[model samples]
Target: MGAARAGNGSDGIATNLPEADDYCLTARDIRCVVLDIEGTTTPIPFVTDVLFPYARSNVRAYLVDTYRTRQTMDDVAFLRAQIDKDLADGVPSAVLVPPPSAPEEEVIDALVANVEAMIDADRKLPALKQLQGRIWRLGFDGGEIQGVVYDDVAEALARWHGTGTVRSYIYSSGSREAQRLIFGNTEAHGDLRRYLSAFFDTSVGGKREPRSYYEIWQTLGVDSPSQILFLTDVYQEATAARDAGFEVLISIRPGNAPLPEDHGFQTITSFAQISV
Candidate 1:
């Protein structure tokens, strides 16, 4: 199905769809490359199937076992931070939860329900991400979870970093720690963690927000945002990167990607399609 089938569709031309000829990188422009996990460098299921389920099955227990404990309060605080951050970033309140028309109790209930639902969806909801960070922390400590990155990731990282072609990093809604765990424990990758320079998560800013991309550039000591090529499967995020002045490429894995939209950036079917 084309993007039109998604219901919230846009004409392909309205978004910038680049031809292969338009893209040129002779392993010179990109001094640093930041990656988005699902749909980009790795499969969506690796995160949704492996990471999400690990966190979900453990969140309640982790909460119950730790409720009122320092960590629980910290998780709540992190979620609250995400909420306030979104509001400050101009994400409409309605998208998360419209202010209740009813009493205070109803509003509180709606808020909790909204957060929980986002959690269930493995969404990037601030609350869910905070909880994911916490759950993964526990899982990692207990040896119940090992982060799962893709087979291609290690080879790609080695090639990029070994040749001094570009520095590699990750940006995901998953906690920075979770991102590290996944990449660090790729079944064959060994500890590829040393190859990365930094990781950013929702705690920094929503992925769809241009400011987050700006922050990433700032962290990398790259004053020019356009100097970096950000690979992501999500068009909104790629839009955010391009809006922030970074180069953008959308990766479409099989059974992944929501049709194709330049979404104000370039699009690719795989990392192999990208020319460093």
Candidate 2:
């Protein structure tokens, strides 16, 4: 995750949540809507079942072939730093430490093994996400993978964007390039990227961090947090966006984690139910 930035609410007026039925931004005041990917826009299964396995199976070959590239080298360097930090913290793993002069194949094998372990554990480490995204790109371009989003998403995005009232954006842990690829090459929606104005990822800040939402608000050049509405399936993510002063709604998508019975946020099962 990127470093957090401190800021005030001076850019936009803050507002409290309205009545339950008034949660729709079209009924209230909103200028921009930020969305999460996995559960909010795309079905969780497409990610856990399709994307994860593909990355886990292809990491070795992808890394071996791409390691010399500047971007891949940067990701590897970040992974090495993470491994070093784990070692300093006394975590033990043969894959975590290898001599700098180790054979290229041996190093790649260890890295692949370690990365596969991280995927199994569902670690959100940026380096791992970067590598997986790169691998997925190859899969996407090879016709081996096709992105999936909920049924209501494509139409809602087009409708919302066509109105010229609310600009749409994506803020996921996936890299910006990966974000574009999914929206651009979706199986159901041909080139949905046209509906989106921008994309953001961990390069902003951790999704669950309040500062991240604020940074998004700032980055989008929006007037106030109240003018932005964020949608996510995770209650914690909703809480973070709410705390950051943006209006937030919990997306109750199929296969999404169940929201708590006492969850305070307003919830929606489809984008058709959302406005603005």
Candidate 3:
């Protein structure tokens, strides 16, 4: 299923399915390669089955145990602000009871419950990402969480960054710190963070929105969005990048969801299949 499906390539030309060479654009003109995390640079199971579960199972204990620490307080404060916003917007969500006057432990308990619920629901809230990133830092530091980046990813990153002309970046819903933790603690290539030039997260904008791609392009200091090749497994992401004028490719990796046959974006089975 990792093989590319039959579809129209990004160039608006139809070709034999999975013809890697045909999708390989001229490398000389490409200036940056922005990658998605799950299913693109890393396997989906590693995230859905491993990291997320780890975060979810440990969140309550981690939060309650570290409630007094400055880092924990900062995250709690952010979550509180988000909750306030949700309440103001009339969104139904768990809230810290007896606002502004609740005992510290009680407030922490409520926040922990809300955060855990967000994790279970798989909501991409910034506060949740921050809390998870902090927890994952501990796991990574203790050797309990070794990130699982795909074998081809390290090589492709090296090749792209080897040239002073082309740079490599990561743009995922994961927080920048979470992105750093994974790349910095990968099982293969042992800290491939050196190969990455920068990281972007949902903080830039929603992945499905074209404006997010534009913000990424502007942040990369590139004038032409065409100089950047955005690789992701999700069709919506590919469409967003294409709309933003960045070259796009649908990554077909083991454990990734099947792409629609009629999806017009070009597809590649391995990073090695991509030239730049």
Candidate 4:
């Protein structure tokens, strides 16, 4: 997700849009709406500020507290594999995770180092994302964190769900669990998960890869890729979805990174702009 200014309850429409009124999903025969989280439905700062920091500060405690659990063991194994690959590739800041027989403190230290490096680099590896999701689940469940989304998101989701003609899905680099935690515990609308049909993560593929969008189309069970509309703040992701034959819209939320002048995709600043 790219950065832009926060929304201020206006229509939030972008100026000089290619075709002012051409953003209607109904006009394009769209049936599914796949949304991006950060910098799209939710503000980028919420993730960069509240979520990332929460995960970073609590990772060590989370690991230590859950150290002996089967899930943490599984997470460790997954991280070890990724870190091994990273080490072989001479990834900067890559550290060796000790064998499971090693002292627990030593293992946790190595894992924490590697996890911090991955988080600092904003790497979208599934292992890092999955672990972060588990950490965040604790924060969300403990009332230490509340998900933040654009003001218009809940109403738009409700409108689409009410129609029964459109399905809303989330596609993010964040893990599926993280996606659920945010939408399920939003500040504006508690339990927005009811509005969403499914969640997708990097397991399908990288967000920038066209094949990922192809896989999403197949999983959506739509008649054609054209029936799916994807919204994102990243130019590359929009291009990827468009390349895969899905209708694409670039979200112009506050704090979103600037798009290329020639990006050539239609843009929307609020979900209300989408007439589903």
Considering every candidate listed, which one attains the maximal lDDT? 4
Q: Report every candidate's CA lDDT.
A: 0.67, 0.81, 0.82, 0.89
Q: Write the per-residue lDDT of candidate 1 for residues 88-186, one digit (tens) a residue.
A: 777544234333244544434444654545656556675676667777777666767665566566666776777675888888887787787777766
Clashing pairs in 1: none
TM-score per candidate, chains pooled: 0.74, 0.89, 0.88, 0.93
Weakest lDDT window of 10 consecutive positions for candidate 1: 1-10
Candidate number achieving the greatest TM-score relative to the actual structure: 4
Error of 2 at 10 (Å): 42
At residue 41, what lDDT does model 4 achieve?
Answer: 92
Give the total clashing residue pairs for model 2.
1
Scanning candidate 2 in windows of ten residues, the lowest lDDT window is 1-10
Give the per-residue lDDT digits (tens) of candidate 4, residues 1-276: 133333232334334334324367787899999999988999999998899889999999999999999999899999999999999999989998888999999999999999998988888999999999999999999999999988788899999999999999999999999999999999878999999999999999999999999999999999999999999999999999999999988887767777666467877777888886
Better of 2 and 3 by TM-score: 2
- What is the descending lDDT order? 4, 3, 2, 1
Q: Which 10-residue window in model 4 sums to the lowest lDDT?
A: 1-10
Q: In terms of lDDT, which candidate is stronger, 3 or 4?
A: 4
**Candidate 4 residue spans exceeding 4 A from truth:** 1-22
Q: Any residue pairs clashing in model 3, and if so which?
A: none
